[model samples]
Target: MSGYLTTHILDTARGLPAEGINIALFKIENGERQKIAETVTNSDGRTNAPILPAEAFEVGQYELVFFCGEYLENHGLTGGNLKFLDDIPIRFGMDDPAAHYHVPLLLSPYGYSTYRGS
Candidate 1:
């Protein structure tokens, strides 16, 4: 099997899947960034498909930017003008071309956490 990337978001404070969050995937090479994929999380807090499909997978550094501010605001979970958390970007490297990369975000209005998931 070849490598691919998947992700999801859970609203920890709400104890539910974070629906309708926007996410972007970018490949970083030579100190520059190039967008590879963009999708909105579904009702299950997951993209419809792999952000980086195996056919387009490559071994390198990548970033997943989660647009959390709008989601938080839409759900009435944010402050008036200043958001403690907005767009969250997670950067990491993919070294194996045949492994699955599952990165998930646990989010709240003021903070977030991520880890490599299976």
Candidate 2:
């Protein structure tokens, strides 16, 4: 099987899939953010497929931008005017391109968590 980069989003406050949330994957190059791909969470709060294929994975810094504000408002978890957080961005690194990277997000209107997943 080929290696890949994958992600999932879960709304801890509501205990459901964070559907419809927009997510972006970016690479940090020369102190600038270069977008690699963009995807919106499906009904299950996951990408349709792996975000990065083995051929695309590289050893470098990366970022995942989660559209938390819009997601909360759309799901009635928060009002549209809420400002606790807008687009929350998580930055991490891929030290080994040959391995799979599963980045899962556990999110709430007020906070979020992420870690290297299987």
Candidate 3:
């Protein structure tokens, strides 16, 4: 099977799937970010399917914006005070678009971490 772009979110603070989190995928064009797709994490903390299908993969700079603050607030993981993170954006390039780009985010109310995955 061919590879594609995908992502998953893990709420480290809550120790569960970060369900219903909004995610947007974009590609940089002419020094500006252009929207490609937007999706919300399912109950399993993953998009319904890959963000970019194998056939649609192309070499370019891409970005993934994860709306963590709202997810945390709606899930009761945050208090009434203003949340620390609003929207977290991960920017990267598809050096080899043919290869799978698995970007996974491990998130908390105050911080988050992400890296290229297999």
lDDT of every model, 2 decimals: 0.94, 0.86, 0.88
Task: Rank candidates, lDDT, best first.
Answer: 1, 3, 2
- Would you estimate the TM-scores of all the predictions? 0.97, 0.91, 0.92
Per residue, candidate 3 scores C-alpha lDDT tens digits across 12-117 of 9989988999999999877899998899999999999998888777888889999888888887767668887879999998877458989999998878999999
What does candidate 1 score in Cα RMSD to the true structure?
0.7
- For candidate 2, the TM-score is 0.91
Please provide, for model 1 over 4-33, each residue's C-alpha lDDT reduced to its tens digit, 9 standing for 90 to 100: 999999999899999999999999999999
Comparing 2 and 3 by TM-score, which wins? 3
| Candidate 2 residue lDDT tens string, 1-118 | 4467999999998888888888999999878999999989999999998888777778888999987887777767664565677798999888875789999999887788999999
Flag regions of model 2 displaced more than 4 Å. Answer: none
Error of 2 at 55 (Å): 2.4
Pairs of residues at least 3 apart in sequence or in different chains that clash in candidate 2: none
Model 3, runs deviating above 4 Å = 1-3
Better of 1 and 3 by lDDT: 1
Position 31, candidate 3: lDDT:
82
Clashing residue pairs in candidate 1 are: none
Best by lDDT: 1
What RMSD value applies to candidate 2?
A: 1.6
